[model samples]
Target chain A: MELFQNLAQGFAVALTLTNLLLAVSGCFLGTVIGSLPGLGPSNGVAILIPLAFTLGLDATEALVLMTSVYYGAMYGGRISSILLNIPGDEPALMTTLDGYPMARKGRPGDALVLSGVASFFGALLATIGLMLLAPILAGIAYLFGPPEYFALYLLAFCTLGGLASKNQAKSALAAAIGLGIAMIGLDNSTGLPRFTYGEIHLFDGIDFLVAIVGLFAVSEIFIFIESHGKKSAIGVTLRKVTIPIKDIIHCLPTMLRSTLVGFVAGVLPGAGASLGSFLAYMAEKSIARDKSKFGHGNPRGVAAPEAGNNAAAGGALVPMLTLGVPGSGTTAVLLALLLTLNITPGPLLFQDRPEVVWGLIAALLIANFVLLIMNVPLVRLFVSILSVPPNILLPGIMMVSFAGIYSLSGSGFDLILMILFGLLGYLCRKVGVPTVPIILGILLGNKMEDALRDAMVISNGEISYLFSSGISIGLWVAAIVGFVLPIFLRPFLKTPPRPAD
Target chain B: MTSDRIFGLAVLAVALFYLYSATAIQLGFLSDPVGSRTFPYLIGAVAALCGIYICIKPDPDPNWPAWPIIAKLAAATAVMYVFARLLKPMGFILPAAVASALLSYLISPNVKVSIIAGICLSLGLYLIFRAALGLSLSPFGDLF
Candidate 1:
């Protein structure tokens, strides 16, 4: 009843004319950003956060807009994956495994529709789950102490870092690098700079936005430059977009299953939408009667990952809202946005700032419906975005990223740092290191350190405190299982593991 | 590939430097039972270990881009670096325009089109940020 009351209150806030309009605009903008190669959901949200602030939207409204963009980007990413064989983002990478081949078979429209439907279902199911689960999770999370929280974060690291890449050591290295990046500013406990190296700007630490812009957006620019204006051969059949009733019926199970898989993965820290989609794709391939049908143009392939990743996007919000830890890179960026508005996310957020939390949930539900409606009829418009030459698009992205960052900090020094991070990001990609872990490390690093120190201080410097509670013990076991289980599962999986995106 | 191996070793070197730096951080005050250096040291050690492992056994050969592609990448980085350096002194429009135009030109070698695009994008962004959003972006001074 309380949850229903909260939901009603949330709907009341979210249904306002301004909030609804912002949601629609966010979805539209998100689609554009997401459909464009080299700019994904994270980039869209990061670029827009400052803009949203500049619009003078209150915290809840800003979040609603940003989250709508987040959902829209998820929907938009599928378009390029299906049509261009280039994934708009990491989660969409798996969509390309099946979606692209299907498109190339001259059924681009069908592929788009199937994936769109799948994304709709994924987001829908996940939102419903969030409505039911978030409050309980937050209530439970309220009881977590420093050690338990540390264990939980460690669990996230082990699960995400371990399952994400083929090589555990490499993922761990990426995580360490992220933590290193996070340690750049003044120590919260001591007030002494850890890695400032005598620079005034370094005192505040590397801005996550600067790092994300360089890592995701700027590095993408370098990639686009390397691509040298080459265009994808768009499948020209231009058939009317239609999914047969039979095909939808066939993919229904796959979509539902992947939604579940994606939601669970999204709720876990470190295991992001990419993992969810990948797992769902693999699961579908393994269970299908004709495993060979996958990757060759199976509708299920398109459906599975689309549903999984979108559902995971919703699931990813759970930990972020309930526990104040992000399950993925985009959510981490979202967390930064919330922190900017002094809206600290944690268990208390539900009680103290119910409007912001419930309003976001209500807005997201409406946004997903809007995206589903918009994507079906306007799919062609998004595909046409592919025709825009890289020259124009890249320059626009650069200007936007530059202006966004400059507006936020107004410190050109931050822009310089953004470039350095950009270069570092490019090099990391070249070397096969997963950048998500690094971003997660930076986002979670300070908090992880704080929790560890608090646990130690509580137990008078005894390491045993970290392992004392049942919750802590359970987390450690889960972490170890999360780390080791994937290696064993690797052989049974029929699909070749995608290289870390 | 030799490139990957070299990268691994380079990472090891950086990790070593990081570890050294971690040790160098002064233990300012005992604000917590475990000092700030502990986490950094752990990360440095883990990173160093990973670097060593990677160096000993690098992944399969990565396809290194040709010299031309590398040049393009370098150019892109340089353009961004210059844009950042010039952002405050020259203001947002000039550096953004130049960078955009230069980057666009690199992608498609048309000077006029690139310049027009650059100007359009800079001005458009200027209007959006300054006029629409009310964020004070300097055309030529420290905004702060």
Candidate 2:
């Protein structure tokens, strides 16, 4: 009953003219940004943080806008995947297994509609899960002390070690690099600089936005330049955009199963949409009576991954909102943005700032509906957006990124740092080191240390306090299980089951 | 594969240097029981261990970009760095225009389209950021 009251209040806030306009514009921009290959939700949200700040939006409105974009980008990624065999974002890799083949079979419109419908179902179901589960999780999180929090952070790291890259050693190396970077600047506990090397600018630590833009956006531009203006072969012509009712009914079970699988994976701190969708695709393939049709223009293949990824995106938000631990790269960016707003997200966030928390929830539900409406009838229009050449689009993005970073920091050195990080990002990508875990490490490293220190202080430096509590011990056990479980499953989830490109 | 192994060695060197720096961090008497340097020490150790592992057995060599592509990437990066230096001195529009023009030209050698895009992006972004959003980006430095 109280949840109903809070949600009603949230609706009142989200329905206002300013918030509604923000959501609509964010959705539109997110779709366009997400439709572009090489720029995923993390970059989209990261680049837009400065725009939100420049616009002078209060924290709540800014969050609403960014979260809307986050959802929009996830929804928009499917358009390119289905029409052109290229996955717009990493998680969309599974969609191309059947989506491209279906498009090649001259039912481009149908493939898109099915994916769109699946995305809509996944997003809606996941949002519903977030709404229901976040409160309960938040309540449980209230009991978490420093040891529990430290254990949770450890679990996150262990999970990332398992999921961030194909090679655990490489992923561990990336994470260590991130932690080392985070160790720069003044250490608050001791009032001493660690890696400043006598530079005055290093007193305040590296800006998260600068690191993010450089890694995700600027390095992407480098890759685009390397392509020398190569365009995807999007030759599919769309006549109509409707799925038969029977097809929708047939895929309903696949959608439901994927939503559950995605939601579960997403709620965990390391299993993101890519894993969720990959698992869902594998599950669907194994269970299907005709396994041969799994990747050869099967509509269920399109539906399962689409639904799973979108649902997982929603699921990823639960830990971020309730426990202040982001489950995925994009959510990590969102958590950083929230921190910038002086809003520490945790169990206390619900008690203290129900408006911001519940309002974001309400906005997400509405935004998913908006994406469904926009994507179903206007997907062809969205696809044509691809014709905007990278030459034009890429420069415009660079300008936006430059202007945003400059305006936010008013520091030229941050710009210099951004480019340097961009080069590092390019090098990392070239070396096949996944950068997401590095970013996650940077985001969580300080907090993890603080939690550990706090626990030690509370326990009077007792080493055994980390596992003294049941919750902490359970988290440790879970972390061990998560790290070991993926190795056994590697045979099935081997490198996304991809064929030669 | 050899390049990857060398890269792993480079990582190991960085880790060693980081560990050295971590040792130099001055600690206060009343600092947290775990202390600040312990975390960095742990990070350095993890990095060193991983670095050694990768050096011993690295992934297959990823396809490095050709010389021409590398040249183009370098030019693009140089343009962005120069744009940053020029942004505050010359303001948003002029540097943005020139940088966008340079970038677009790099992508496509067509001068006319590049120039038009440069103009549109500079003025248009100026309007969006300055006029619409009220961000304090000067149109012509602090001359106004």
Candidate 3:
């Protein structure tokens, strides 16, 4: 009953004219960005952060706009996968395995419409799950002390390295570098500067937004430049778009089961959409009557990953909202947005900012419907986006990044700092070091430090105090297991088609 | 010999430098029992250990691009640096236009199309940033 009341109040806030317009535009831009090869939801949201800030939107409006883009990108990723055999992003990689094959068999229109419906089904159910699960999770978070939070953050870093990257050492190094970067500027407890090198701009820490844009957007331009604008050819020409209702009904069960698997994967810390999609596809394949047809343009192949990845995308938001810990790379970016807006996301957020939470939930619900309605007729429009040449797109992205960063902080130093981070990101990618943990480390470093400090103060500097509680002990055990289990499991788990967020 | 080994070496050097710097932090009188330096020390140690591990067990082969591609990437990076440096002195339009043109040219060698794209992007972004978004960016810096 209270959930209904909260949801009704949410609808009232989200139905406003400005919020509606933001949601619509965000969805449109998100779809276009996501359709571009290699620019996933993380970059999509990172690129648009400057615009959101420049518009001076309030907290609810900004979150609503960004979350809409997040969902839109998940929907849009299948476009290039089916049409060009190029997964638009990492999670979309599984979609390409069967999506491109399905397109090659003709009936490209049917393949696209079926995937869209599956994405819609998966995302909608996961959003409903988030609505019910987040409140209970928040209620439980109220019981967490400083030790528990410290242990939880440790678990995040450990599992992120263990599960997401091919090399846990490199991921650990990236997290260490990120924490080192976070330690710059004036210390919160002590007034002394750590790594400022006497620059006045170093008084305040490096802005996470600058790091995000530099790493994701600017490094992308460098990659594009190296490739020399060569990959814009469309592989499959679309016939007339169709509804494909029969395929939708046939794949409904696959979508349902994949959503369950994906939601669980998404809720697990550091296990994101790529794992969800891969697991869903593997699960479906194992249970199929005829295994030979699984990867050879089977409709279920397309439907399962599409649904699983989208559901996982939705599930990643649960930890982000309820516990203030982002479950995925994109959610880490969103966490940065919330912090910039001066909103501390956690159990207190529900008590203090009901409108922001409920309104965002309502807006996501609306955006799902909007995407379903908009994607079918606008399929032709989004397909055109895949043909946008890199020459134009790269420069345009560069301009947005530069202009946006400059507009945010009228400081030249930040621009230089951004470029430095861009170089670091490029080098990390060159050496197969994952960038997501760097982001997670930067996002969580201060909070982890604060939690540790608080715990120490409470326990009079006894290290055993951190392990005294059952919850803390459990988290520590989980962290150890999460970090170690992936090494042994690596042989069994299928290697991802590409590096994931 | 491998790119991973070189990267690992670089990380090692950075971690050592960071550790040295961590030892130099001046603790305040009212600092907590854990203190600010403890976290940095822990991070430095972890990074150093990871660096050693990566160095000892580096990946077999890394697919590095050709030297020509590396040169082009470096050139593109130089343009971005210049753009950042010139953003304040020359205003948004001039620096943005020049940087966009240079970057476009780097992507493809067509000069005319690059310039046109540059002009369009700079102007289009200006309108979006200044007019539509109401951001406070001067078009021509202090020149006009």
- Among these predictions, the greatest lDDT belongs to 3
User: Candidate 2 DockQ score?
Assistant: 0.80
lDDT (0 to 1) per candidate: 0.84, 0.86, 0.87
Residue by residue across A1-501, what tens digits does model 3's lDDT show? 999999999999999999999999888888888888767888889988887888989999999999999999999999988888877677888998778878888878888899999999999999999999989998988989999999999888888766667788887888898888888889888778988888889889889999999999888887777665455544888988988888789999999999999999888777788888889998998999998886678899999999999999999888889888887888889999999899998999998999999999999999999998767777889988988777888899888888888889988899989988888888888787788889888888888999999999999899999999898899999988988888888888874352111
lDDT of 1 by residue, B1-144 (tens): 577678778888999999899888978744677897899999999988988888787788776778988988888888888888888778887778888999999888898889998999888988888886788688766543
Interface RMSD score of each model = 1.5, 1.2, 1.1
Query: Candidate 2, residues A193-292: lDDT per residue as tens digits?
Result: 8889999998888888888888888988887887664544655666777765677789999999999998898999877888788888888888999999
TM-score of 1: 0.95
Candidate 3 root-mean-square deviation in Å: 1.9
Error of 1 at A195 (Å): 2.0
DockQ of each: 0.73, 0.80, 0.84
Which residue pairs clash in candidate 1? Answer: none
TM-score of each: 0.95, 0.97, 0.98
Model 1 chain B: which ten-residue window has the lowest total lDDT?
B135-144
DockQ class, candidate 3: high
Model 1 per-residue lDDT tens digits across residues A265-305 = 89987788888898889888889999988878889998999
DockQ of 1: 0.73
The true-versus-predicted C-alpha distance at residue B126 of model 1, in Å, is 2.0
